[model samples]
Target chain A: MQCFSCGFNAMPGSTSCGRCGANLSLAKAPIPVTPPRAGAVAKRILPGWWALNRRMAPLLLRIGIGEAALPALAVPLEVVVRPLIAMVQRPVSLLPGVPFIVAGHRAPGWLLLAVWIAVMLLALMLHGLPVIFLLLVGGAIALHAASALQATGLAYRSVGARLAGIVTCAVMLLGLFYLPLGWGTMRIVGGGWWVVPVRVPASFPPFAEGDIIWLDRSAKPNLGDVVVTFRPQTLRRVRALAGQEVAMIDGVLLVDDVPSPWQSALRPLAEGVRFTVPDGRCFVLLPESYPPGGTPPAPTPQPTGGWPYNRQPMWTVVVGEREIRDAGGNWLPSLGSIEGRIVGRSYPLSRFGRIE
Target chain B: MPEDEDPQPRRAAAAATAPAEKDAAHWLRLADEQRRAGSHESALRFYSRSLEVDRTAVTGWLGQVQMLVQLGEYPQADVWAKKALEIFPQHAEILSAGGQAKCRMGALPEALVMSDGALARPGESAYRWLVRGEIILAQRERGDDHCFDKALILDRDWLVPLEAATACLFHNAPAKALKRAQEAVERGPTSPRCWFVQGECQQRLGMDSAALKSFSRVLELSPQHLEARGRVTAGGGGGMWRRLGRLFGGR
Candidate 1:
C-alpha cells in the first residue's frame, strides 16, 4: 500500500509508513458505510435552545429514568458513572484552601442509623400487610391516576414531563433506601472506620489469623533473621543466609561445617545425602509436611549399590521432631527446608498463597 | 625471519578483533553513563546499541525501558517493557516498570491486573507495591481505598501511598489523608515531596503548627519549593514569620 501521509511506498496491507513512520490510515478520510440523509445534510445547526435541549434530553432521561432503574438493574451503573463525574468535577472544583474532604458529603451516622431503622420498620409494616391488600392499594392508585389523566387530557399534553417526574421520584426513593445500606456495607467491607499500618517482621511465619507482620526492610537483615519471603510454589523456610556454606549431609543441614540445629529435625535422610550450598545461595525446606511427633513408614531395604541409585524413604529418620502432620499422621518438612527467608506477607490474607 | 612473518599475521588478527571488543565496551560504558546522567534518550540509544552487539544482554533491554519511563515516553517504554517481559516474564523489575507505564497512560484497570500477575510471582520488591498504589489511585473507584491501604500495609516505606493519600483527601477523607501522609513521612523522612504531602494533610486537618513544621522541612530539603513557600505565606499569622525565618536560616 502507498503511505497516504508521506506518499512513501509500503508493502501491501501496511497501516504505517516504514520510512517516515507516519500513520497512513489516519491520513486517509474515514469511509462512511452509509451516506447522510438529505434532510440531515440540509439543516443548518444552531447552538441555542434547540441544540441544548436535544443534547440534554438523553442525559436528563439517563439521569432521571435510567439512573432510577439502576439500583434494580443487573449492572452497577453507579460504579461506572460516579468516577466519570468525579473526574470531571475535580478540575472545575480546584480552589485553593478549600479542603478536599468536602468532595462527597456523607450522611451523618445518626441520620443513617435513623434511616435504617425507619426503613426496617417500614419493611416490617409492609410485610405485615396482606399481599392482596398491597395489590388492591396499588391498583386503586393506578386507576385513579389513569382516570384523572384521561379526564383532564393534561397527561397527554405533558406525557414526557409526567414520566420524568415519576422516574425522578422512583429513583430518589430507591437511592434513599439503597445508598445508605450500600455505603455502610462498603465501609464495613473496606475495613472499618480506621486504618492502621502494621509492620510485618521479616521472620514472621506464613499467614495465620492475628499474626502482626512488619512489612518494611529498613534495617539490614542478619543471620538467623526471621524474614518474610514470598514464594509461589510452596510455603517453606530459609535455612541459611547468603554467603554461608550450606551443605546437606544425607539431608542433615550444615552451615559452614557446623551442623545447624535444624539438621537434627531432618535425621531421616542423613544417611545418603550430602550437597554443598553454593555462595550467594541459601538452603530452604518446607514446613513440616507430616504430623508433629508422628513416625514415618520404614524404608524398604535395597541392594547397597546399583547403576541407578535406589530411592530410599528418608521420612523415618525425621519423624518425631517438630514437623507438620498430614491427616494420616505423617511427619512433614519444616521451614528450614525452603529456599528463601520470609520478607513480607502478601496483604488481604485472601490473596496470600503458599510460599514455595 | 619466520618469527617476523608470524608476528605480522598475529598483529593483523588482533587488529581485526580489537575493534569489535572496543565497540562493545564503548556502547556498554555509554549506556551506563547516560543512565547515571539521567539522559534517558541517549541511554536508550546506547542500550539499543549494546543489545545489537549482544542480544542476550538482558540488562540492556531493562535499561532501555527504565530510560523510556524516565523520559515520560510511555508508549515506547511500554513496547520495550513488553519485550523485556517476553524474555523474562517473571522478572520483578520488568513487571513493575511495565505496570507503572500502563498506569501513566491512564490504563489503570489494566495496570492493576498486570501488577497482580507480577505479585503472583515469587520474590518482588517494594517498587511493585508502589506501582500498584499509583494504579489504584488513578482508578479512584470505591474499592481503591482498600488497595491503597493494602499497598501501604505491604510496603510501609513506599512514597506512593503519600501521593495516594493526597488523592484520598481530594476524595473526601482528610482524616485518612493525614493518617496516610504521616505514615509515609515517618517511613521516608528524607523525601521533601513526602513532607509537602504531610503539610497539605496537616493543613487540611487544621493543625497549623504541624503544617508549618512540615512545610519548613520541605523548604529545608528543597530550597526552591515555591508552592510550599506560598503555603507558608497563605497560612499567615503571628508566629508564622518567625517560623519562616527559622526555616530559611535567617535566625
Candidate 2:
C-alpha cells in the first residue's frame, strides 16, 4: 500500500509508513464527521419553490398579509446584478457642465453660478413655489460634479498635473471641512430661526417695515422681552412674567405696583386693566402705539367705530392665563399662540444685531 | 273635480317629477353606499357622476373633496372645494375641507382663516372640528388637543378619536391618550390602527402584559406588520433585545 502522507510504497499490513514514518491506520477513519440537524439540512438542500411554499403556505390561517411575502425576504441574486449592470451601462450624468469646467470657460461657470444665486434670492424674496429650491439644489450638484470630474481628468494629465492635483486636493479638503460646518449650522438654527421681512404692523417703531428680523424659539422670553403672537397677528412685548401682578393705570403700565422702563415706551394705556399673571402664563402688551394715530407711528391704519373701536385699545394688553383675553373680550388664541422672541434683526443692515 | 283637470297637464307634471328625482340625487346615494363599503375609488367615480349630472350639488362636491384628501391629492381637493364655495359661498363643510387641504399644502395662515370661518358657523360636524384640530396641530399651537376633544364630542364613532389619541401622545399627555385609545378600541375594534394606538398607550402607561397582548393581536391580524413584529421579537425573546435596540435608535 502507498503511504498517504509521502506517497511511498509500504509493506503489506504495516501499521506505520516505512520512509515517511506516517500512521496508515489513522487514515482509515478521517476527520470524524457529525450529521447536521434535520431542519438545517432541509434548509440547505430544499429547492426554492418547495422552501417558499413550506415557509408561506401556513399563512392561510391568518387574517391579513401574513407570511405570504416571505419569499421576498430571500432576495434573488439577479435583483442586485440587474441594477449594477444598468448603472454601469448608463451611469447617472451628474456632471452636466463638464465641457465648460474642463476647458476653463469661466463665463459658463460664472453664468451657472449666477443662476444658482438668483434662485436662492428669489426663494428668499417671493417665498413662492418651493420647486425653485429643488432646481437650485440640482444646479449645485451639477456644478460640484463637473468640477470634481474635471479635477480628476487634470490630475491624470502630465502637462499641468502638479497644479491641477493641488487644486483638486484643496477642493476636496474644503469639502471635508464643510461636512462638520453644515452639521453645526443645522444644529444651531434648524427650525428655530425664522425671518420676517415686512414691518409687522404690530412692531412698528423698533421694527420698521422692510426690516428683516430673526425669531429665535430657543431663547426663553423674560419680562420685557419683545415677542410675536399670531392670534390677531400682532407683535407684543412681554410686560410681566408668571405670578406678577400687572396693572395699567392712566395710560401707564405697572408691574407689581412698580412702573418698569417699558412704561416709558408705551404710547398710553387704558385705565383699570388689572391682570395678575397666573402660573405658566405671562402678560404681553402691544402698546397703544399700534392704533391708527398712536405714538411711535402706527404701521397700518386701524378701523374706526363698532366693536373694534368700543372694546379695543390702540395699545392692546393680552392677559395670559388658561386662555389669552384681549381687553377681557371673548377672543382666545388657539394653543401655541406665541411664536417666539425677536432675538436678532438682519434686514436693516444699519442696525444689524441683537434687538434691545 | 279631478276630471275637470286635463290628463295631459297631470301627465306632464308626473314626467317632470320623475326626471328631477332621478338626477343627481340617485348618483349621490350610490356614492354614499360605495364610500360606506370602503370602495373609495368607486365612490369617487360615483361622486363625479353626480357632479356631472348636477354641478350645483354641495354634497357631491364635499364627497369628492373628501376622497381627494384621503388620496393625498391636496391641490385637486382645494380646487374642488373652491368650486363648491362658488355654489355655496359660506358653506361650513366646504370651508373646512379647503382649510385642511391648505394646511397640507403649507398655507398655514390661509388654513387658519378657513378653519376659523368653519368653526364660527353653527351646527358644525365632527369632520370640521377634526380639520380644525389638524390645522392647529400643524401650526404647533398649544392646546390643539382640546380641538380633538371637541371633534370626539361631536361624533365618537369615527377615526377622529384615534387621531385625538395620537395628538394626546404627541403632547405628552399619556393618560388622556389612553382614554382616547380606549374609546377608539371600543368604536373601531377591527382596525389595526386603533389596536396599534391602544398598544402604544398601554406601553406608555407601563402596562407591559396588556401591551404585549395588544401587540400580539396586531401581529395575528397582520403578520407583516413590521413594527408589531419588532415589539414581539424584542419583548418575547431575550437575545433579540440587542437587535431591537439597534432598530429603535439605541445608538
Tens-place lDDT digits, model 1, residues A33-55: 11111121112221122223223
lDDT per residue for candidate 2 within A1-356, as digits (tens), equals 97654567999999777764656665553321111112222223323333243233234213344233322321121122212222233333113343354357778766755664565454343332246546665555555545444434342434344344445434442454235545766666556653433245534556654555666665566766777666565666666777788776755567898865575333334466676766666666552223222354433444333443456543343333323453421222222566677766655557767875
* DockQ, all models: 0.01, 0.01
- Residue runs of model 2 more than 4 Å from their true location after superposition: A1-356, B1-43, B49-55, B163-179, B190-193, B196-212, B215-251
CAPRI category for model 1: incorrect
Give the alpha carbon lDDT tens digit for every residue of B1-251 in model 1: 67556687789899998887767467878987665433566877787777666544556666677666656555446656765654444466677778766655544444666788877867655556656665555444345556666667766553556645654554345676777788877887887777887787777666778888888898898788888888776662225564566466332
**Which one wins on TM-score?**
2
Q: lDDT for model 1, on a 0 to 1 scale?
A: 0.49
What tens digits encode model 2's per-residue C-alpha lDDT throughout B1-251?
Answer: 58677799778999989888768888889987776444566877788877677654567778887766555455457767875665456578889998876655545556678988988876758878878876666555565667777888888674778766764664345677788888887888876667777787777666667877877887877787788777776662223554456366331
Give TM-scores of the second chain, every candidate: 0.52, 0.62
In candidate 1, stretches whose alpha carbon ends up further than 4 angstroms from where it belongs are A1-356, B1-77, B141-177, B202-210, B221-227, B234-251
- Proportion of true contacts reproduced by candidate 1: 0.00
lDDT (C-alpha, whole model) for all candidates: 0.49, 0.58
